[model samples]
Target: MSSLRAFVFRMRGGLWTLLFCIILALARVTRLSFLLGLPFVILGQIWRFWAAGSIGRYRGERVGAEHLVTWGPYALMRNPLYFGNGLIGLGWALMSGPWAICIFVAAFALLYLFVIIPHEESFLHETFGTEYQDYRSRTGSFFPKTLPERGRLTGPFSFSVLRKSERHTLWTTLGGTFLIGLKGFFL
Candidate 1:
């Protein structure tokens, strides 16, 4: 693994924070934009919460897959977490300004496509061997795949897992939403 890739992977949180701050700073937020964006935010968070439930505790810098989770959202997409993040980013972009979506999309592609996903995929492929490759072929990376034969892994989706894994995401998203609200309503 490239050291640069590891650094970016580790710095994902900071990068996302920077993106949010950029959106807020360059905002032309309005009531209509906020309203339009709310559904996306809600849906994104829900998707993420569900995905997190299956994945157990959130590991920020650590990149290791202990179990091959092949059920629920994992069964749907190889990168449900990233997909949910995409939705959330789009929502924030919409709320921020007309041009913010372009910026967010560009940033997302650069980060996830160029650095993050490849690194993670390489690790997963090495860690899980044939299982991960099989999953990769059958499942879509960012969307629910229409596999001719979808694989399933048996496991319980725990609320505890969701709570543990999603608190940071929940708070961060709420904070962004609140700031956007302030910008839209007061500023």
Candidate 2:
């Protein structure tokens, strides 16, 4: 189970990207579906940018932050980045239309629930100790239940952090949306 969790956690992003590309290639998108999915994709990007910018100060040359992040979108959700990823994926699935959206979302949810969240929680607990535990006690993993009750607000939003954390995400989202739009246009 641990091995599976590790594998899924490590590969989740790449695997999802590949899946989205394959789905896009196979899908017969319509103008209506593309338009409908556009809003989700946009919202996902906004969420990612907000989370990234909020955590920029703690992101100095490390994957694990020196302190817990609980501001901006983090104030809303424990896993805003994962939530953003879900929205991006759901947007792509919606663009695919029909049963594909259901399958993608189901797979995504299972992956997050069974694999990603557990692995991340273990790491956070180890790194941040009581701070993470208290935060976890108050915060829902994927959904925003309430504003964070603890943790110091980080410094102001940082474009550098946004650029570093989200450059690939932003580019791929735009590219995928463009391809879907092109497919719809041509069809």
Candidate 3:
């Protein structure tokens, strides 16, 4: 892993984590627009679970990948985890029901656009070179659409990976949810 890129990712990861926690706490406190936001949160969690499973199943690393994962969710979205995370953030903001949260969302998007994404892309370009370029050319970075057309990937979506990765992601999501719920009650 490139030290610079890794550092940037870790820093941004911390920021996002903090933002998520704060939003959860506020949501729990204010009750906010829990009705409208809950759906996005649920959808975010579901997407996160799916993306995490895909990553764990294929051994994807946050730093960058060892082998190019061109099957499963990766085939559909070049950056499934980021997309899921974005959804989660957007959902949480909606739940928070504040202009500040919208600003936070916009800032987060900017961070990803200017800092995190570019760093990751440079690393990928350096690491995977042409192959990554080809994949990027064909795949959507944040929105999943169609799988790569070269060859069809087959295999039943395994519950095993889901079971394993969910331990981490699910608990985190549950914590966030509880915090939001508590905020709602207090509000």
Leading candidate by lDDT: 1
The CA lDDT of each predicted structure is 0.86, 0.78, 0.69
lDDT of 1: 0.86
**Model 1 residue 181 lDDT?**
86
lDDT of 2 at 140: 82
lDDT of 2 by residue, 2-60 (tens): 77777877787787877787778667788788878889999999988888888766332
Best by TM-score: 1
Ranked candidates (lDDT, high to low): 1, 2, 3
The residue-by-residue lDDT of candidate 1 on 1-187, one tens digit each, is: 5788899999999999999888888888888999889888989999998888888655569688788888878887888898989999899999988778888999999999889999998899899999999988888888756743444543568888788779989999899989988988898
TM-score of 1: 0.93
**Which candidate, 1 or 2, has the higher lDDT?**
1
Tens digits of lDDT, candidate 3, 1-187: 3575567677875677777866655553344466667777688788766666655463333665666666666787777777777776777677676763766577777777667788778878899989999888877887655656664343235578788756766677667766666766764
Full-model lDDT, candidate 2: 0.78
Worst 10 residues of 2 by lDDT: 57-66
| Cα lDDT, model 3, residue 171 | 76
Clashing pairs in 3: 27-183, 28-182, 28-183, 28-184, 29-183, 31-184
CA lDDT for candidate 3: 0.69
Clashing pairs in 2: none
Cα RMSD (angstroms) for every candidate in the order listed: 1.9, 2.8, 3.4
